[model samples]
Target: MAHPYLAYYCLNISTIPENSSYQSSLSSLLSSISLYATSEFQFNKLQKFLNISDPLYGLQLCHGDVTTEVCRECVATVAKSLAVVCSRKLVALIWYDECMIRYSNESFFSTKNVLPGFALSNIQNITELHRFDQLVNTMMIDLESQASEVPAGSKKFKTKEANLSELKMIYSLVQCTPDLSTTDCNTCLQEAIGTLPVCCNGKQGANVLMPSCYVRYEVYPFYNIIDTAPSPATGLPPLPPRELEGMMNFFFLIFF
Candidate 1:
């Protein structure tokens, strides 16, 4: 029951006319994407609806650490919301905590997109500012390397934890759309990591969301560790499970 973190519409582009052929095609494209995303239990899906008048390209992506159930639910929710919130728009993108959905009249597949990105940071700041920043940079750089090195057809995602102090720890996750090449994924994540200091400097937690990739770090465990396997190269064991599912259920109960 996560709500949308942000949404973007192509305001510069003209909107589709009501009851036009392009509008009808858009509806059908959304329906197909919704059905396939929910039924396939996939972490990522890219779809295109071909029409002589207007073609639509759409993509749906769930965080790599999310469960199939959560992924399915998130995709379904965003798909329905995109149709309503960006009704008649030629291009739009929506981001939820667990998933993101995007559609455009022009295809953006396999490209690195950094514009129209956003950053969100917690209000609380870290007391050890310089030291914390160094750690975040090191950990994020390592994670970006790991995530972007994945083989073709594998998920371009990685997570890591680092000790900030005896009582505090930093948890981070980074991911790129699976469709991107290794070089493209690395570039996308690198650009995203470069923005932390400008937008989130020393906040306890922050996230940068782009159309091609995202990176996040928190003082507390915000991602599902159980679903993240240890990287063979690192020789690290999987982290213990946290009460994330229960927290999600509670969130849904209160919000939905």
Candidate 2:
């Protein structure tokens, strides 16, 4: 079996000019995120705004199927990577197979900005392209609706499967950060699903990942269907105070 914990991609947006206050604010924001990862996982998503001099804002969302421990690991990895890879960037976003982490100078909570998202598709084309397109369109629309209607305080996520043939099936998953209202979540997912024709038409499998939301479908089962309940949030693992110093050193070693 494939390991459930993996990283999919990373996005390093605009950079921050060398400003001491901005750097200090970003450092504090990173520490806050690390602490959140160590402690909270119940909702599988977190959105926080730091009211510092620079006002850094961030959001982190984990795939609902993963355990709280897995979510923590993914968050830690991204936090470390971003500290180095996006050291000077004002906006940094990273997507792990199990979770996502983002931080920026501007506020993005509950806002739907879908540009800069990426699409990936299998190289193999489906023989029944037109029919497959129709099926995907219908299925994604239904999933977008279902995912947006999570029980109060639960993760905004849903997974479903559609039969392409007796032996062939298409598995789909859709999710948004729980902080988003139902309407915003639906809108974000709808926009992503609508881009199927442009990005993944005729491919056997495809996925589009955005900061606010992401939609994925594949010929094979890729999600854990058995565990539908969300994990409870908690505190971070015991870390020596020097851990942050080490993280900072790691970033500097890589870029400087």
Candidate 3:
């Protein structure tokens, strides 16, 4: 059976030079992800050397809402997929509904990257198209502010809903990797939100996933409602519901 998120997107950026040592290093990195990426912390960064000039740097993250078990299963599935699909690549990034895996010969931690991401949107457009677009834009911008606060990093995620009318509501979420500075997080979110007009304007919902951050808004209550209390110390963000896991079908607009 196909993995829950395999149908969404896979990015194979650059290929590594053919060599036995690189192969061994690849094995090491993949093994590390399966073992360490699903700990209490949902994010892990890895840098390992294999008696070679360059070392492999990797980052793995799961959506905050998933359990550790789900994170492990997702990572294992992606590791197996990378072996077959990105066999010769030195640098690759693969994103699933619940998790993302990226490795490179160079460092990307704490840096802002908007490329190598994809946007997914619903096929049905909103009835009050223009007004709905305005609401979405404003809602996402507000969510971005609440999700990127510093300290123990607990503020790097937020989920909120706004009433459009008696019968309509807009639920949205925004998140950034804890490694990013508040400035970078805001910048990254701005770029992602700006793409809505072109990628998801008028749509009933949209999700923009990037290596460093993610933004999503839907008409219905897609995510589980949770407390928004700020943490006393910096830390990982709270887990939201895993609604995306079952949303395998959507229109994809990819960015390379």
Tens digits of per-residue lDDT, candidate 1, 180-205, equal 89999999999899988887886887
Question: Which candidate gets the maximum TM-score versus the true structure?
Answer: 1
Candidate 1 global CA lDDT score: 0.75
Candidate 2 lDDT score at position 243: 33
Model 1, total clashes: 0
On TM-score, the stronger of 1 and 2 is: 1
**Which pairs of residues collide in model 1?**
none
Query: Candidate 3, 114: how far from true, in Å?
Result: 0.8
Q: Which ten residues in a row have the lowest lDDT in candidate 2?
A: 247-256
What range of 10 consecutive residues in model 3 has the weakest lDDT sum?
Answer: 229-238
Q: lDDT per prediction?
A: 0.75, 0.67, 0.73
Q: Which candidate leads the pack in lDDT?
A: 1
lDDT agreement of model 3 with the native: 0.73
Candidate numbers sorted by lDDT from highest down: 1, 3, 2
Q: After superposition, how far is residue 203 of candidate 1 from its true place, in Å?
A: 0.5
Cα RMSD of all models vs. native, in order, equals: 6.2, 9.7, 5.1
What's the TM-score of each model vs. the native?
Answer: 0.84, 0.76, 0.83
